[model samples]
Target: MPYTTAPVLPPGTLSRSPQPVLPTGDGLVLRPWRGRDVAAVHEAFQDPLMHQWHIRRSDSEAEVAGWIEGWEKEWEGERDAQWAVVDADSDRLLGRVALRSIHLVDGLAKVAYWTTAAARGQGVATRATATLTRWAFEEIGFHRLELLHAVANEPSCRVAEKAGFALEGVKRSAALHQDGWHDMHLHGRVRGD
Candidate 1:
């Protein structure tokens, strides 16, 4: 029974266009993941800090390759979009940013990101998030984007705030890490905000 308004965004909204490379205007670029980025991705997941929040690490290049493939498939499926944050001039991988858990019918998605140790303190995550958010709103026509992080993940909380996502509330025991469950902070940003 289809008793509802029209979908906020139609099918093939994102899949129609090729994934785009975005500029952060802060000396960083958000580009689609490439086969050559396996090393950087592998190294990033190996960081103890990365494992703390993401709860997974790449043990081999092969696994990272599969992960890249999955990102590509997700883009083609229009279910998610992932980008490798890199130095604009050097093109060296600095981190990653993504719009995950996309709901095209609702024009919504959950944004996520992480920065390499070397990229830390450089505002890579925040700048990349902002750039992606603007694109999702203005270019792709998403209505709302969410940012979620474990309460204990203070750095991510900061990034979300800096990227202009307003803290709406906390979800109890929302995420499960290797250590255990953690309460999660939920931040949200609509197209105008």
Candidate 2:
């Protein structure tokens, strides 16, 4: 069942040849992940919000480091693009944003993001999402980008709206979290929208 033909597009069509750095124009920088970011990444995931929303959890530094390494592999395969959201002034970790499940044939992708507790309420997620959306649409030539979050996560919904993603609809009981199945709201933005 594993055997199949090649993908619709050759490698490097979805992801940038060299991952680009995106600046939010508000002192927030989105850049490639580094090995040295393990500590900060580990700490950020320790936040209760991350645990509540994100299914993947990293309990140890080694696990966090592996996660960072996977980002590079994702880029190499043109499967997805991830960036560490950092503060330009101090190079501190603010959060992370990524384009996941990128399908070149459909010209569609999903956006996922998280913000450290300290960085929340400062528009970090909104800014990062907006910057990434623009980059994906204009630079990478993606036709559409989508974002989904548990219906209970109001802040994330707000971020999606502020980033210009329109609410499409809700997928009832579509996501499983620690609290069990939760309804998810899907928001999307198409090129030129």
Candidate 3:
């Protein structure tokens, strides 16, 4: 049956404005992806760890550019919101952060992110996630956000906690990595959490 009440977020919520640049209030910022970032994204995908965790990898700069283009299209469609996490001082691409699988009526989305090999362990993911969460809830009027990562991904789990997501449970054999099916850890944060 259709919802009897109003959507948690209105239809035009995301599309009303251009994608925003969010500040980490530390040393990083989440900005809209640029065409120039193709090379850096390609390099990030080259890391074996990125390949092991993410099912797909950018095979070439062309593919990465296409991915960035898709991000813009998805943003307009209100299905996804993507940002390139960059260094505040240098504007170097450090990673990416995104809200995927967005559901406007439900006010829910899946949080996703990745940091470069050199940026890992520097709290880049955590900072970006936290900054994005605040924007999602405060500005976009989302009610909840969920983050899921492979069970073996300890660093991601830590980032979730640091970004204020609670460990909800595990989804057994939820994701297929290059190696095989892997259990996934599910974490979530609701408004006011």
Candidate 4:
């Protein structure tokens, strides 16, 4: 693992200050994605839990290439910011956490994340969520952040709870899982609320 410098902020001037890279308790650093991260990301995506929770199998090589392209675009300020979670001590890629669906006007964004199976039960998701949430509220000045999880994902729900996100409510048949439609728990945390 190597220490990579932060991506240059996107072209247009941002109304808010640039988001800073922060380190979590276990020397896990939350920073922007890099080209070298593609392999690690692809490896993590191969995990069955990752497929069930995040990536859709229909995601082809082209689609992944497009995503990596978008990652650069996002870094250049053309899109919402995303990050790769890396170990500060070993500089190994552990997972990814991002604030997506950014609506600057509404002051709202959705937080989504997944950890490598090897990193589970180590509080990686919880710490990453907390670090990113703090960045969203303080650095990006977002008023609200949302974390949504499928009802079946107990571990994810626990991560949300541990990160201080309130269980707002569940939407019945909100999304279609592989088997069928399922409920989704929507968790929220607001700045100063």
Which candidate tops lDDT? 3
> Residue-wise lDDT of candidate 4 within 1-193, one digit each (tens)?
6327432232242424444577986689987676777667777777878767663653455566667677656644524767778898887888878877776656777888888878899889899999989877776567889999998999999999999999999999888766788899999998985
RMSD of 2: 3.1
Alpha-carbon TM-score of each model against the true structure: 0.98, 0.93, 0.98, 0.84
Question: What are the lDDT figures for the candidates, one per model?
Answer: 0.92, 0.89, 0.94, 0.77
C-alpha RMSD for every candidate: 0.9, 3.1, 0.8, 8.1
* Alpha-carbon runs more than 4 Å astray in model 4: 1-19, 58-63, 75-79
Model 1 per-residue lDDT at 87: 98
lDDT tens digits, residue span 1-193, model 2:
5327554444568554678888888899999999999999999888888889999877999999899999967887766889999999898999999999988766788999999999999999999999999998887678899999999999999999999999999999998998799999999999999
Q: Pick out the ten consecutive residues of candidate 1 with the lowest summed lDDT.
A: 1-10
Q: What's the residue-level lDDT of 86 in candidate 2?
A: 97
Ranking by lDDT: 3, 1, 2, 4
Could you give candidate 3's per-residue lDDT for residues 74-111 as a string of tens digits? Answer: 88899999999999999999999999999999999999
What TM-score quantifies how close candidate 1 is to the native fold? 0.98
Error of 4 at 93 (Å): 1.0
Writing each residue's lDDT as its tens digit, candidate 1 over 99-167 gives 999999899999999999889988999999999999999988999999999999898999999999999
